[model samples]
Target: MNYQAPLRDMRFVWHEMFDVTGHCQHLGLDLDRDTLDGILEEAGRFTAEVIAPLNRNSDEQGCQLLGTEVSTPDGFREAYRQYVDNGWASMTGPMAYGGQGLPQMASACVHEMLMAASLSFRIYSGLTEGAVLAVHRHGSEALRQTWLGKMVSGEWTGTMCLTEPQAGTDLALLRTRAQPQADGSYLITGNKIFISGGEQDLTDNTIHLVLARLPDAPAGVKGISLFLVPKILTDGRRNELSCGALEHKMGIKGASTCVMNFDGAQGWLVGEPNQGLSCMFTMMNDARFQVGLQGLGIAEAAFQGGLAYARERLQSRSLTGAVAPDKVADPIIVHPDVRRMLLTQKSLTEGCRMLGAYTARQLDLEHGAPDPEDRRAAMRRAALLIPIVKGFFTDVGQEVASLGVQLYGGHGYIREWGMEQLMRDSRITQLYEGTNGIQALDLVRRKLMGDGGAELHALVEELSQHVEAAGHQPRLQEMAGAVSQRLEEWRALGKTIIEACQRDPQEIGAVSVDFLAYSAYVLLAGLWLQAAVRAGETLTDGTGESAFYQAKLQTADFYWRRVLPRASAHREALLGGANCLMAMPASDFSC
Candidate 1:
């Protein structure tokens, strides 16, 4: 299947929906539309022409580990060289670090394209960028001077080494230890599993941001300290870290997920001692948002493949009549069921793009806004939406990929069609970057109930204002009202969940996933409404392509009618509470 970057919709979201250039202007960054367009076009070309073709081949060959060296798939090394030489990796990095310092909005678009082209290949640089962000934010001036420039130039890749074999999500159980030395550096000794790009050979050196406890540190998560462990030492001797083994994963085979053993590796602490979790979170949050974009990218690839197949693959005649009378039978696109599946993919993918772009813009505002109040507001908004973006986008990504498979009937199951690869690749998104369950719990326990729902309430009010402001346009007035009503419903549901959680803390976990999904659907509805309003205005003024705007309106309508109703079921489940779920005994399934 051929992959085309959704540049038009991305531009629509950036310029029309989010006004990213205006946001950049507020940051005193001279990022005009033309510059962003050029970046997108060039990135699109690279992904489509250079990176995308290697996706399947790379997956087929996978990564190979012989001795201490791990080799990426055939084309991956060359592709990484091209990616670095083009200055793509440094787009969002600091200007002082040899980066172009573009807004995250542009990086988000490029990231989506790269992920769509080859998620397995993209994982390398994706993790590197996250590591760079962390070290830049939390590392000392000397550390930054040593690592930031090399990483920003893509000369050295980085990894986040947090998950120990015994720890997983429970960071409290981590037993990794860092022993201090007289020279101020420490020796990091730990085994980190599921470490992406841990031991890849694409770069001369791999910088690992490890989490370990000091000898005199307290127990549990509080004792964890962040360390920078490099594979190669400053004097050019190899460090003690090695890839014990590569995980035989179900997907993303080309990306090396290694079990790393840091046997007293020379390292320097990042941030303060025993503050590793908070320090690592800076990287994890960036990674989580990028993972959400990965979800969006994979979903888009599946949607395009499915749509193309639906258009060309002739099947039974349409219920109404033979729409393609000249052919042997009507194309499956004529079938209502096929159309339903396709529309679901379309609405979810496009809506996710808008949400991701908006969130990326929020990230830009959080970091670059001159006003402290603006920064705080953006941070709160980002915190509120990051979990949803990571969890819901990944869940919907799997859903859309499944729909793509179903649309292909028997063909999708085969390897040649490439739909199954998308499904397999997207399946991991929900698991990593703090699993969707963790995200849901964070949403309900931390973001919502933790703050008395102030951030959420403020967001609802802001969205309400947007809806009311669009009341003048007849086409958008109804959508605005519909979305406004859903927002109130969402707000009420949050209160109900909070009240229930007060009665029984278990209620938080019980309703958390449902609440997250419901919130995500409503949030997407609001974004889709915003996009629909813009599309409608364009169509009304006869200034843009009629077909594009009409398609946007139709997808928005489908989302309201079809996708939005799923939130109602989620609400019902949320109200059901923990009784039914908890009533069953743990041992009952053993029989």
Candidate 2:
């Protein structure tokens, strides 16, 4: 079977778990349940019908560099045109720019479907969304007038050009230059590597948000400025920039990763001079969160594929008894080990979707919440979750995809099965959008320290209330208690890390990944327990979705009993201090 869009589960998370309907209603979106349902169902059909079939072929054919331009694989450009014509591109764009003015949550659900269908195709649109956001938020009025409409309408696509040959994560060594011109435009001259869709046949123009330095500027990141250099200039002539080459990659090859050379490309400034990092960061958060969805999407696809294969592949009888008496051996689903792997995938993919929806909700509130303090609180919480959403999801995503491979045994390792493609594609999500390590350090330094952990405390308090709400129900009491205990431990660990950071700064990087993993587990524990709460409430209230709710409760039990205990190792490891890591000399490691 082809990949279904998980529309039912999307509704469960959006309408029931989070109540995005009411939230959007409050924001005057007027997006009713039936309307939202129609939107999702339609999008589901499109992705399953149009995008799903292209995955295997797209991988094989990939994108090709022809002369000075990059050509996407077969059907990519056509599908993208259909995607744009159907108004999918402007789902969450600015209303002023002829967009639908929907909440980010709505767009996020759609994106999850797209990512599951074709991550390669989704990459192109995801970059455009980020570029639109950067331009809408920080671009000057004139720049906005010139660019936003075209981008929102899908007449053009966009890219954020930041990385160079020498600079990957460190912006301090960036050498891209922007020379001031007499006519108020700047000449952007630089080389950017791994530019996704740097040159593509998808659109008439590409609006590249390039990060470069001015002639008279500071020597580090502070001096960097964001500039808009169109592939085709305002007068409709091709700009000086060209696609020098494309990277040969292990996966996501259908998406162009070009070596973009900007040769005195005419451009205009965005945001304040020397504040490019700050501006790009604002866009990066969106990009990273979207990458997190990519992780979730790939995991969902793997789970679907693995589950389908498990149901059909006969291997051995159940340990208890023969499940298929007529057959020589029972289907693999009957085996405990197979069930364990499938269950783990189900739990993580579904649990991460819940977490993703929650994060998206917070993001919507950050943008659309009317109250100032409400928006601020949502902003803080969203900032905290971005790394988790990007780092933890992708990390586990790889694990889940690998489990899918394991489910298939030897057949999974080869090309024909398509399970290994997910494993390869999922790997990049963790590496890019700031490696999971970078996300860990970011969570430690920025979100943790920004307001002295006020947001963390707020989250803890909210989880505490949910724990209390689940107190009286006998079925939920144990799970609630487990989550409650984790909440306390999570809070204590944060305090410990902050104190340790005061003593040694390297302590932050050393414990960062562990802490992130710990928090990811604890956060999912809270969300899972809360999902159980909702499920149980629905069950008791005679909502009649017994199987769905029961499965949710069972999964919550698995997460609490089987998965969450792993956080203990992370906690102890982080508490062990940085000495274990810092004591090792760099040169001695190679020996």
Q: Taking the candidates one at a time, how many backbone clashes does each contain? A: 0, 0
- Residue lDDT tens for model 1, 1-591: 888898888888888888877888998998788987888889888999999999999889999999978999998989999999999878778899898888787789899999999999999999999999999999999999988998988999999998987889999999888999999999998799999999998999999999999999999989999999989988999999999999998999999999999998999999999999999999999999999999999999999999999999998999988888898999899998999999999999999998898898889889889999999999999999999999999998899999999999999999999999999999999999899999999999999998888889988987787787668778777778889999999888888888889899999899999999999999989888878888888888999999999999999989998999999999998888799999989999686
- What C-alpha lDDT do the candidate models reach, one value each? 0.91, 0.91
Model 2: per-residue lDDT, tens digit, 171-203? Answer: 899999999999999999999998888899999
Where is model 2 more than 4 Å wrong at Cα? none
By summed lDDT, which 10 consecutive residues of candidate 1 come out lowest? Answer: 469-478
Residue 586 in candidate 2, Cα distance off native in Å: 2.4
Q: Candidate 1 — number of clashing residue pairs?
A: 0
- How many steric overlaps does candidate 2 have? 0
